[model samples]
Target: MPTPSEFFDPSFIAILKLFLAMLLGGIIGTERAVFARQAAGTRTFGLVAMGACLFIVTGNYVDVAYLGVLSFDPLRVAAAIIMGIGFLGGGLIIFRGDSLHGVTTAAGLWIVAGIGMAVGFGLYLIAIFATFLTLLMFTGMWFVEDRFKHWFEEVKGDSR
Candidate 1:
């Protein structure tokens, strides 16, 4: 008659988890949006993360009985994620003779998936912390790389 199982029920908690995935992904994505200068920005990353999380959560349901009986292999969802991630990462990588583009975006998407996965499993704390760390690493890497480049140039000049 009514809801059979809380897991089966479309509860606010489930929706909230999905929302959290988007927000956490966006938090890290903001940097990618403006700075990485990729076609896929804040909206893209946010949407991908939330969409993946929903896919995982819904995959866990999916009325599996249609095939034979209702059963889910969370690992299947994880495997799908990994396969899709490889494609996304490849999308971000472009060879331009001697330089590359979209590597940052690729890495960002990769990290965002972990955040999304954490949210899917209802690990809110991990999701939050991961979001923060992702941002820190994303922002920090540029400065560190730039400084290292300058140092290398200076050392070369001294050697000359």
Candidate 2:
């Protein structure tokens, strides 16, 4: 067997970690693509996740330096990313004569960013697990909401 150093170099480990983050982030994004189509689809979600991951990685690297120098906040980048993403989301939103749409797309963008942050921290299991849970919620939530709405309406009809 190789030595510990050979098996684990800091550079290799960091790179591998970053790659895994991108992979998992992409997976989370695919879930969003289902509802974000025609607005912020698969490619947009993937980009958002990767961008957030990079911002979080930078935040980790410059946190101490910025803190020590009193030059800037390391979280500034992340804050800016979040704000800019909000603007993008707003653009995606629509209110056509009181008919609302695109909120799901906007929310997906936000969630993709969170997944990226998890990946940036090299929390592979959490990131992957979160992706599964998010997907499940995205699908099951709609069904649950619809079913409840139908059931409530049926009961109300009987009462009437």
lDDT of 1 by residue, 1-160 (tens): 6543455655566687789899887877778877766687788788778977887777765644345565667768867886787798888799999998888788888878878877877777988888888887878877899999999999999998
Looking at model 2, which ten-residue stretch has the lowest summed lDDT?
31-40
Error of 1 at 59 (Å): 2.6
Q: What overall lDDT, based on C-alpha atoms, would model 2 receive against the true structure?
A: 0.72
TM-score to true structure, per model: 0.84, 0.75
Candidate 1 shows a clash count of 0
RMSD values for the candidates in order, in angstroms, are 4.1, 3.7
User: What stretches of model 2 exceed 4 Å from their correct place?
Assistant: 1-14, 34-38, 63-73
Pairs of colliding residues, candidate 2: none
Clashes of each: 0, 0
Global lDDT of each candidate: 0.79, 0.72
lDDT of 2 at 123: 66
